[model samples]
Target chain A: MELVVVSVLGADRVGIVAGIASVLARHNANIVDISQTVVRDIFSMIMVVDISKADVDISQLRRELEEEGKRLGVMVGVFHIDVFKYMQRI
Target chain B: MRFDPREIGEVLEMLVFRELDIRAVTLSVNTLPAIRPNLKDALDALSHLLEPYARRLRPAAEKVASKLGVRIVTVRLAVSPTSIMLEPLGDAKAAVEIAAFLDELAGRHGVDMVGGFSAFVHGGVSRGAAALIEGLAEALNSTERVAGFLNAASTMTGINLEAVRRAARIVLSLKPHAAARFAVTANLPEDVPFMPGAYHGLGQPDAVVNIAVSGPGVIEAVVRSLPDADVRTLHDAIKRAAFKITRLGELVGREVAKELGVAFGAVDLSVAPSPKVGDSVAAVLEAMGLPRVGAPGSVFALALFTDAVKKGGAMAASTIGGLSGAFIPVSEDAVMSQAAAEGAITLDGLKAMAAVCNTGLDMVGIPADVGPDVVAAIIADVMALAVHLDKPLGVRLIPVPGARPGDIYDLGGLYGRVAVVDASRYSKIPLVARPGTAPPGVERLKKG
Candidate 1:
């Protein structure tokens, strides 16, 4: 299964998680882990989601998250776990 | 799948946020534009120039911090030397105005400290630079977030007695907070990209980038983990850990430079400590079995720490530089602060320690009425050490303007706190009878 990590950050408000999770759920993504924090008005979150079982393309998933991010006034990006690990291994 | 509970616990421990791993990365950018037209223009341009970088620096730093599972504590900025930048201003008051402008900009942008308000007249001094140096004690005393330095000598230009004398006067007039912000140097390297002294030389391009990585806490942690570990084993472990940490810092620094499209100047493994408990260079020394910083074996402890850190960091990165030795700032290091308070360390003792280590007389507190000649004496002693040892040494002596010995001044924030050290009660010793060329082979003393 292809694992991907998604990070989101925006001004603190409600429904941020639900909005992003709805998009992930529609893509048949399985969230293996999630963590978040709110420091005053700034909100940040990270999720490890798996999408190998689904037939959806990674680009499409990215586009969906981007659209949702814009609607919520947040920054959202998806990265392959392998790419993240390689960048960290330096 | 077979799973061991202990292995599961280890994974969970990594995920749990027990410690806040944060590093302060300062980008020393040239801000000569700020002082070009007038104090107002200087302030406006500085604020504007830094606004974009401030916005981007956090996101960029946070991106890297997230990857490393650490936090970016503060994104600080250091500018080109203030004396040269304010040369057109032409007076001490104007220099102070420019310093205030920079201080205001730093406060607005949430920067911890902004450096480079300094003069490098090691050989001779210009009239404008002299006036600025005269006002530095007051400027640093009155302002927060402003740091200063004076480079009194270089390998090319021999030490300037006049500038050194003026620096002594400034230090004597320095208040506690101001004293902590000041650094005096000999043979100041051109490539130092970090604070209180970063300036874009006329020879450099429009802008360049450098990185300073501090992990005294990490070193302390490594040392603490090895209970009953032999000296050789301890040294090897410290070196290996420093190598790994330096490699990680080099990787991040290179990436940042690549993203910014600037030259990667160098990676400084300075082991700089914070005021936070357990993250101090002094604590590292104490861990090595010194009863306190100025204890009998303090010099040996610092020497060993400095040598091992250099050995590891030099091997880890090709271009390693800066004040890369273990920082022994009293206020910044918990153990040092405690030692100073308990009279376990004296000003002379600290100077002795600096002779065998990196920073020279850093964050040391002293009385206000101390003579300029004595302050000059301290600087000269450290200069002699640097010259004799052939390594970089800096004196960040804070002469509290009104406080006397046994008095403690509380300079809040990372500047830390310091107890006043007794000033030497005797007459000053004369080192240089007259200003002349340095003897041949003096430069050879700096090898290593």
Candidate 2:
């Protein structure tokens, strides 16, 4: 199983989590952890998900997520769990 | 279970509309003219000098605004005293020409306000400084973004009756549209990073950054949440909140200075407020048990609030300075403005309040016909208080054109709006004319 972290940031609006979650669920990704905070007009969220489905490619999932993010007026970036953990340690 | 749409709408509104976090970006630019032989050449130099800075200023400001997710209300510039450049302009025509040049430059550059069309004749008035004062009304009236100031006295240099007298006349004659942009001061500090008072001094770096952190809402929210808190408890809570706010301000100011590669000037922890509901300096005073800001106990309340804020801010940052007190700007503060409009506060009430707070007679709109000597007298009273207390204080009263007592002038924007405050009909009391004499100092009390 491959673990990944997805970070999203943008103006606080409707359907941000549901859209991202729907895309992840379609790829058979299991959400493990989620944290979110709203400060002023901006919304920020971090999600950790497990993606072990052999049929879905990580690169293809990233493209789909990017499209979803653009449609939702949010910025989304995906990173390997190991890389995210390393950056956090620093 | 069913959810109410009204409740959801209310929550969304609270999230999006209720939360306001905007920072005022004041760009300090020196307007001391580059060496030039003719007026045309001088204007050209002015535009040329500003062009480079202007090109990068708006974009950088917009980027910061976007990143912070807060609106940048103004992209303003503060120039060195125009009096320095007006030395060669011997007559009113020549002075007006300089004003025109400045106005044109400001318009072309898309700057909202340009300060430093001023003179600092604390002890005595020079020829050029006097000329700037004489032409001030015309210059201010003719220009859109130009602001003016006059430093009438200082501790080092005694009060200049000449400058004070002239400033009074200039302010009285100033147009209503331009009145908000003009300020008069005694002992105006050299390193002020705000305007219509910022002027790059020789002691400052070629470029320096200053921040004015304003969150009256935060303070008010803290106070309101503890409705049953005692005065001491309330003061303690305010201090803690102020410490956090000032620390955040210091961090942002330091980062911005690092990015600009200039010295980080002080973080002015002035609780500057807007006309928006629930953000007010007077509300803080009201929370302290005063029915209104001008009540009998108001001055003492202000003293406590001001002292506590300074104590907390000083502890928060090493470089805490500027007017680091609660701003009592009448028009800018919704409650104070309302009080003035309802006749709950008067000009004398404001003067009494200034004894404690650093700002005296700030943004208080008055009549145009008010004599300069009377204005000088009012300034003298406030200056004497500052000297007596040995604390920083300033007076920025606006004598709105064609306005009188009971008239309201709407300045709009961050300046907010104000109803005209009635001027004191009484005259001055005779006092000694000594300058630089230290007042009786208060002994510091040791806390257990």
Candidate 3:
């Protein structure tokens, strides 16, 4: 499976998760795990997704997520899971 | 699979806030095999061999950067020492032509710079080395995308004072900014991704990929996170940060090499800093509790930090080459430049720091009146230190024309601004005039 980690950070607001989830659903990406937290009104969400079945490639998915994030007033980043594995696991 | 939010946040913080990124990914191409009896044939052979790789480097680097969500700064190319290619032709004019052609090729292919317009005269000079040296002033002065190096000292071969003199003269003759593109090295490593010291050594493969990681900001952030931690704790924290940083470089390097269909070489774990805010190595030292970079305990602080970086890099990557330590290039780092401007760091103090760091007195500006003998003496002193420590070190200086001590020469952009440091006190070392290689250091006896 093509695993990826999607992160969104910004000022806390409504529809942050729903906005991201809708994009992922439209692309047929499966969110396997998610953890989120808020501190001093700043919101951060991390999601691990399997993009193997997604119609869009990683770059295209990133652009779409980023555009959605901009509409929601947030910063979004999508990275191949191997980066986390290399930097954090080892 | 378990995912820790804090771990994810830490990686993001390192990237977004600390400015952690890969500074350089250099493709070291072997061009010596392309040399022919005539300069035209040699140029044709080199163009045929190098064009495709240059065309592919930037795209491959950008792809990896996008995939990993990492910022890859500069893509560079290093050729096998052009002096060797000039050996058969035995023409100084050919050296300049090759440098210009490489410069044009690099620009055409979007490569930032092409290095290894070099002469390795650590022990003595050869006919080709002589030709290259004769034309170095013109080649470097004329080309914007070509970088040059002269390895004039080594532990095994000793110091060549004559070569040092010649290198200093070349420095004196270069245009104000062109000196930034030149370096005189002692025991320069082969696979360094950073110019102007990088060159594809004789021992390297035909084509390979090497990487340089930059993370002074990350290290400083780590140091600041532990406000009350002891020295050992700071060391551990820095080491951990370096491990993560090197891993990123290793991953990017291997992936880029795979994309380009070349061998994955090594990760150079130099904590490179830029003039940008929050990206200063001196700031890391200050975060570790030194009041300033050249403070009394500066040497100890540098030693501790450099050793921990190497330790962390060792654990992170299986194959490590190049100068695997911190680089304290004066003009390129804001805090370093400020310290120099404030008289907090002198050229002598920088020399002391280099005993523990990688390159010696790099990117420093000196007065134009210091003379070649004085500059050569400075280079000689760094070589002496490298021989004693038996490690690689180098010197790259800019003698700003018509500038005086305490005057700042604003080189602008990555070159930054530099404060002219006094080299007059040591200005009259007669030892530089003697034209022979100093005997090899006692450190070489270890091999026996």
Candidate 4:
């Protein structure tokens, strides 16, 4: 499976998740898992999305998500899931 | 979440906020095969051999970096030490010509820098080594993208004071910011992905990709997160951070090497720092509760930091190479430069720190008027330490033009700002003028 870990971090707001989810949905990327938290009073969202079926490539999806994230006043990063596995896993 | 939210969040925080990134992805290309008896043929062969690899480097690095979302700064190329390549030609002018060609090649192909204009003269200077050393000033001065290293001292070969003197003289002749691109090294590693020390060893395969990881900011954040933690706990925290950083380096190196159709070499676990405000090894020490970087407990803090990183990196990567200790480049790290500017750190203090650190006397700016003898003496001091310690160390001194002690030279952009530190107290030393290789350290005499 071509999985990606998309993370968003910024000030707390209403449309941050909606803005990101819509972009992923429009690209046909399926969100498999999501977890949001307010750590140190800063809002952060982590989403594992299956990008294999996406209409756009990872770069295009990243750009759209980032643009939407900027509109929602957050910083968004899209990385292949292996980045996490390689770093965090034994 | 597929993984723990905290784990994902931590990785993001390190990447996004903590200034963590792969410092360099250096492709080590063996250029010995390109050497020909004729200078023109040699240049042609070298050009043909390296151009394709150089051309692919940036794109491959970018492809891996974009896919992994880990920024790989500075895609560099390291070749076999130019002295060896130019030896057969027996022409001093050939060094400058080759340097210019390599500089152009690097620039045209989007390679950030090209290393390995180097000579291994730890024992004695050969005709080829002498030629390379002779043309070093001109070659480095004229070339923007080429970096050079002179291994004047090593554990097995001892300290070559004559070679050190020659290197210092070359440093004196270099133009502004040119000194930043060259180094006089002791026990220079063949596969360190950092310049101006990287070189393809004779032992290495035709090509390999080595990664240098920079994460002083990430480690500092880890240290800062444990404000009241015990000493061992603090060490463990640092280890965990270093593990992740090395893993990132390994991943990037493997992917880039695969993309370029080369072998993955090793990850240099050096916690290299940039000139950015938060990205500093000194800051990491400060975060470990030092009132300032050069405060009393600084050495102990650095030792602890480096040891933990080595341990973490050892566990994380299959093969760890290069200068795996934390780098304390004065100008390139904002805090260290500030410490130097504030008189919190002196040349002697930095030398003391280098006793335990990876690189020695790096990117330090001294008074412009300081004689070659003084610089030679300093290089000799560093060489002596490296010989005794049997470790890798390098000295990159910038003799800022017309600058005095306490004056700040703003070289700007990655080379960063340098505060001129005093080296005049040792200026009268005539020991370096005594031309001979010093005997190896006591470690060499040890028997199993």
Candidate 5:
């Protein structure tokens, strides 16, 4: 309930950020932190969202983000924070 | 704790895109109190007693997995073995009733399986044990969720030829649909999560939770990235990947256990494979540079992978029970099935690899014409390997009636598909291998 990890990756294109943000906002998952960059025309972004007050379940948010990602020709992934802490720590 | 985006992104990739999952979370419950005679008076009391213990099982598991974005393949239960509970009744009819009762509980809770409709007869068999074994096919055939196993051999006990033969005949008699629900195991641990072999051993706590973690796709990705690395680096990479995968299981398992107020038993670090392309253990082996799973250099490939998995997983979890190694179940794995389909991996080769890996001749499909004696022989050979090597092993062979070797035997879904595998030419063997009169080290080993 504290925060969820959301990552997006694909070719740099128009409205990728707005598209992702609008969907997240609509679900009431407030973005606590955001980082985005375009390297060699392939765009990558990571957002830390606080979903303690989100309007939808994590699975529903994931489904919507995936659909928007498809429309934007990108791949979106939403995962629990434990995945990050366990795999990256040791 | 906040995590760096790049580090977290990599983990998200593994979870979201790589098919990582907590394969199963099994709740081992105590059903001893419900063991009563099959009378009108007892059936009503038994259901009332079992209802409260399992009432929240499925919901608790689902809530926890959903909150964490973890995909839990199944929620199952392992009760006290049925043979002991029905021993006093000495009625096969009562045993069948118990099996149906358990399965009904599972259906109501939407649980995937309920194991421990089983008997351990390596030491000796009794009248009730015989009744359960003879009634096994009927019990399993009648229930969708019931699972049964016959542990006929153990490392310390040598082998029980009689039990092995009886188990083989029972397997042949099972309704084709019941094949997936029954297993013949050797040297199984107390807290394994795989079915249809999982049962709560006498030593286990009354209400413990065991987690079976599977991530073949994640492991294959690691091996694929280090294509040219030497043996040392490859081993290290595998260890690192296994550590991460098993840690996920421990974390999720502990949380689920805590939420359910049950004792956390162990993290079973078995790398489960399915028919899916990337999820096969054989695919992970192929990623390690073998052309295919059964080609030259395949056995050593499995040896390396299995050892590294155990080494790495042990570092992550405090208690690792179950079959904690890479499983090579044919029909359940695409590469293994393909290897059998092409005749690249023979049944003998499977036995040889079984010595080095976790299980023996697992999920193997043989010719429909093969007799019960031959099937019993194969199982006995596997039993011997487990006792000699001091490892836990199981046999889940499928005798696909009307299907010849190399033909596709499709059981469908998670039971998967297997190409019928050719066995060594059968030779006549005694119905029960004559027991040795007085083996030298047997008593001392049993005592120790």
Candidate 6:
């Protein structure tokens, strides 16, 4: 299955996770794993999802997350897992 | 194995916060095939051979850098030295033409600078070497992208005092802004960085991909976080930090080399700093509790820092080569420049630092009216250390014509702003002290 990492970072706010999940559900993406933390009062989250059965492609999902993130006052990004894998291989 | 979120977070922190990067990705393209008797034929051969390679390098470099989230400071191309070409070409004009052509090719290919406008003249001055040295002034003045040097001293060859004098005279006479693009080295390496000294040495492949990794800011961050740590703890922290930093270079460098279809060369293990704030190597010293660089124990700090980095980088890179030590460029590193401005770092102190670091007297400025003999004296001092100790050393002296000590010369971008240093009371060596036999390194090279 094709996997992607989606991240959101900003100050603490309400409904950020639900709002992100709402978009993923509409696109038929399976949220395989999720992790969140608050460091120095900044909210950072990372979600790994299976994109094999998604209705929309990664680019479109990234655009949607970016638009939604702007409205929610958060910074959002999407990336392939290969980059992280290369670093963690040792 | 399943990946962890913390691993991703750690990389993101280094990329976003620490500003880790690959400083330079140099592509060495062979121009030995282009050396010829006729000037036009040589130029034609070079353009034909180099055009396609140059065209593809920048695009591939940019694509790889962006996709991997690694910022590449510059993409450079090093050619084989042009000194060998000057012999059959008949005149220095061909040398000038070749330099200009290299400049044009670099401009067209979006290569930042084209190195190896160089002469390996340590066997005293040959006819071809003399022609290159004679043409150096005009060629550097005429071409923006061309960088040149003369390796006139070595551990085996001792020192080429005559050629050294010529290089010194060339600098004092021309005062070419591009003099910063040239250097004189002793015991120079086949592969190295912090140019004007980096050249694709003889017998290396036509095209090789090498990387110079930089992360002075990251080193500073580690030292800062360990405020009260003892020397042992501090050393461990820097090693851990440099291991990660050089790992990024190795991974990305290997990928870049694979994509470009060239041999993967070394990752220069240096924490080269830029003019950007918070990116200075001197800042690392300050973070280690020194009020300023050149203070007491400063050189010791630099030595330990460099040694630890080398140890860590050696562990990480597939093959660690190209100046596996620290870079102490004054103008390029903001903290270094500041120290110079405040008179905390002296020229002599920097000369001492160069002995321990990878390069020598780099980006140092001097008064415009300094005599050639004085320049020769300064180079002589550094070259002596390089030859005696057997290390790669390059002297990039900027002599500001008619300027005096404490005057600042603003060389924008990577070269940065440099304050003219006091080189007034220099030794007067009126004659080239020629010896009966060649230096030690040359004898070994011959026997080998």
Q: If you assessed candidate 4 against the hidden native complex, which CAPRI class would it receive?
A: high
In candidate 2 chain B, where is summed lDDT lowest over 10 consecutive residues?
A: B439-448
| Candidate 1 ranges with C-alpha deviation above 4 Å | A1-90, B1-22, B32-55, B66-68, B191-194, B201-204, B258-261, B401-406, B427-441, B444-448
RMSD (Cα, Å) for all candidates, in order, is: 7.7, 8.2, 1.2, 1.5, 2.6, 3.1
Candidate 3 lDDT by residue in tens digits, B1-448 = 4568788878888888888999999999999879899999999999999999999999999999888888999999999998899888888999999999999999998999999999899989998999999999999899998998999999999999999999999999998778999999998888889999888988898999999999899999999999899899889999999999999999999999999999999999988999999999999998888898899999999898999999998888869989999899999999999999888989899999998999798989998878888999999999999988999998999998888877899988778888888876766778899989998989999989
Query: Candidate 5, residues B199-266: lDDT per residue as tens digits?
Result: 87889777889999888898899998998999999999888888988998888888889888989999
The digit string of per-residue lDDT tens for model 1 on B101-199 reads 768777776767777788888667876677679779778877988887888756545556667777787777766667777888866655465555555
Local accuracy of candidate 4 as per-residue lDDT tens digits, B1-448: 2688888888888898899899899999999999898899999999999989998999999888888888987899999999998788766799999999999999998999999999999999887887898889999999998999999988886888889889989888887678999999988877889999999988899999999998899998888889999999999999999999999988888899899999999999988999998899999999999988888888899999999999999888879999998899999999989999888878888888998888789999988789889999999989988888889999999988898877889988778898888886756677778978898888677622
Q: Given candidate 3, what's the lDDT at residue B414?
A: 78
Residue A2 CA displacement from its true place in model 1, Å: 10
DockQ of each: 0.06, 0.07, 0.83, 0.83, 0.56, 0.37
State the displacement of the C-alpha of residue B201, model 5, in Å, after optimal TM-score superposition: 2.0
Candidate 1: fraction of native contacts reproduced:
0.00
Sorted by DockQ, highest first, which candidate order results?
A: 3, 4, 5, 6, 2, 1
Quick one: best lDDT, which candidate? 3
Q: What's each prediction's TM-score?
A: 0.77, 0.77, 0.98, 0.97, 0.93, 0.91
Q: Which pairs of residues collide in model 4? A: none
lDDT score of residue B76 within candidate 6: 89
Kindly indicate the candidate among 1 and 3 with the higher lDDT: 3
Question: Between which residue pairs do clashes occur in model 5?
Answer: none
List clashing residue pairs in candidate 1.
B34-B42, B122-B152, B179-B398, B390-B446
How many Å off is the CA of B122 in candidate 4?
0.9
Among these predictions, the greatest TM-score belongs to 3
Candidate 5 residue B145 Cα shift, in angstroms, is: 2.2
Q: How accurate locally is residue B100 in candidate 2, as Cα lDDT from 0 to 100?
A: 76
| lDDT (C-alpha) at residue B209 in model 2 | 61
Classify candidate 2 by CAPRI docking class.
incorrect
Scored by TM against the true chain B, the candidates give: 0.85, 0.86, 0.98, 0.98, 0.95, 0.95
Error of 4 at B317 (Å): 1.1
